[model samples]
Target: MDTSFLDSLSDSDFDLDLHLIMGKKSSQKKFATMLDSDDTDSMSSSTSSMRLDNMTENGLSEVQVGKDDLLDQCLDALYEKRGSTREKALASIIESFNSSLQNEFVETKFATLLQQCLNSIKKGSAKEVALASHAIGLLAVTVGPGEKAQEILEESLSPISDALRIRPETSKILSLLQCLAVITFVGGEDPEQTEKSMHIMWQVARPKLGANVAAFKPSPAVIAMMVSSWSFLLTTVNGWALNPKSWQESILYFSTLLDKDDRALRIAAGEALALIFEIGNLDKFCGENKDSSEPTIDEGKDSRKLMYLHGLRTKILGQVRGLSAEAGGKGSAKKDLNSQRNTFRDILDFLEDGYTPETSMKIGGDPLNTSSWTQLIQLNFLKHFLGGGFVKHMQENQFLHDVFGFTPKKKLLSGTEQRMSGSEKRMYKSPNSALSKARTQLLNKQRTLAQGRNAGHFAVDE
Candidate 1:
């Protein structure tokens, strides 16, 4: 509570301390008052007002302020400008509060900060909005996982919804919303929370997706960001897929990505589809048959069979065919090629261990009916293009062997001594073999010459 240290600290640090000690209510009021006072005539007046507000709300009395003032002075020395000072101060405060805040403090103060940040998006300068968004992100991570955080998040949805309506293009706000979704879904691992998270995302994303598609053609950046964000949220599909409404929306969103003109979007969409399939399959496999600890070939085959019988595979393959045709003609084919390869690799890798034709066709056990198989085939087409003869190779090397139960023998090198006669191996049928032969011949000629020289030396000595 050193007053001198506190006096010298940046606004952000001061705010952080106030937030940690006095709580959100006091800190917020102080921030509002600091911004409100007109003292525009002098920088000192503004700084003083901010300082006074901090002192009044923090209730540091005297001794603590003195120590804090000195620390604040040290902090002030680190920044020359007011804005930079504020940013660094805010970051420092967040860092400090992150370590000290209790669960209750986090639930209430962190939630308030998020709401305030979202509200700030409607009116603050872009920089302020970005800072607030960053702060909100930090809170999301620090809050940890629990019903408390979940309840706070539920309350937060309305403000985010309002912000989306008021300022849809605000990237900062969008980022904040995405962070919240990530925390609720990925961080918490609470199925109920994830369902709720997906509900919020669908509400916002559905309209955006429609608008993006409605544009004569959406900007690549817009499409890319949308798909990326959507994919990120879908990564938490474990909880979401449990809810029928969320599952339907998830399918619809992925379907839109498949139709996008941007290859990147399509790739992201495919990845998301694969993830959803994996999640659904894992859940079903784990729930119905608790005896098996790991997913079996039978389960995978069943999933793939279900996917195909339901016509999901055909839909995905159709998209892949279109993408491949477009990729072949474009000057940007290499990039397209790699993206397609990665997408296919992901799908194939997911299914390679699980797939079996027989298992796929079993009752209520069909793999082809699920989206997993559809995505797998689409990815397979891309693999065929990138690996050139991939399908045939799989058939010849692995699939055929698996079906026929054939094991090929390893071959030994023929004429090993003739292959390495000299320093430079002689040419033979194969390039390596030829080189080895030339080396052997060179060594033999050198040995003969050395033998003659030794014999002459021995005769001269005698």
Candidate 2:
């Protein structure tokens, strides 16, 4: 095994997200306090300065300006003839997006931003194309599961496909794969739409070219990415709606990937298989399409399919058992080895005991929980895809809130906001505050009644 390739596997696992272009994180505070508040125009100047300071630290010092203005500048830059200029503009836009939710900006400029990004995909350099891909994905996330999301999917598919046809660099391919997964996950209104995107992704891993066309075999990294991205979109699809024969073939194909030398490829295949089993329609995925009331076309054919599925399951179980206890090989990355072991172990546990993995995490004072592989995969994929903005969306994005069934306790307060004094805190219930006014009126009416009963009774006269 090539050590460099093995090392690449370790780094490529979750590198599909925007962390590549966003660069290293500097100590930064979120600027958008209005995320929790209704008034968008009420951000204090001090907090605005803090936001600018963070962006300056990220090397956007010269472009320190209001969010809308910065976005406008980026939009204008996208139209510039230079690829480097467009790349910087796309990077700035991605930074702005990952730092905060740009709902208002997206609402007004959604089409324009998307069209520009797609143009970049069609014309820009590989780096620019990757950045453009990341920007569009963030756009889908910001819009989040509605008409706008669907429109994004519709518009992005063609240009992205055209880009993929050229077989760009590994980074560009990874970015485009993730972008496809994200847009489809949010915008795919039905299973068919989701499956269409999956088909596009799957072709990268298993391409079929004409006799004269040069064959483009995917490296392990690309294959792993294809599997991971395909599985991410798979979580949104309904198993019943899938083609039975195709999935059975997929099961066979993924099982083969488990034996590959790349640890990341094995881990991704393991997760994909685990999700398939978790869906628990083995009969459907194994090529049995007849309803219970319908007569069997051929008993022998059905039986053979069942037997074939059982053999595949048994083979996979044995393979998973070996991987769960795999010893580290020479030249193998310890981290990658352990990750493979852990993942396969989880898959083995689920296959044998019928128990899915459960996990929990804090998302802005709210518990985002997942008790199944499907939910966990969805959560982790989106987290990596959103990167810094995960918390922002998890906290304030209603679409995500609905998807995850998460409701935050309260909006997060900014660092610049001052703590209230005891008297000021009490004033929230002191009848002067707007929230307490109605309750105060009710209390005043009650006080009037109570005074009559106790009138002149201070000395026990009553």
lDDT of 1 by residue, 1-462 (tens): 669976888999978887677754454334333333344222220011223335334333322334334224323322323343443333333333333332344433554455554554445544444444444544543443344345446655565555544444445444545555544532434456655655555545455456443423334444444445544554433332364423433544565677766677677676665544444432221222223344466757556544432454345545545554544444656777676765655444443333211212111221122223322332333232213222332222322122122222310122354455553543112113233234334433442333333222111111
- The lDDT per prediction is 0.42, 0.71
Top TM-score prediction, candidate number: 2
Candidate 2 residue-wise lDDT, 174-247, digit = tens: 88999999999777777788888888898898876788656888889899989999988877655667765455
| Model 2 alpha-carbon miss at residue 60, Å | 6.7
TM-score, per-candidate, Cα-based: 0.45, 0.74
Q: How high is the lDDT of residue 334 in model 2?
A: 92
Worst 10-residue lDDT window, candidate 2: 27-36
Clashing residue pairs in candidate 2 are: none
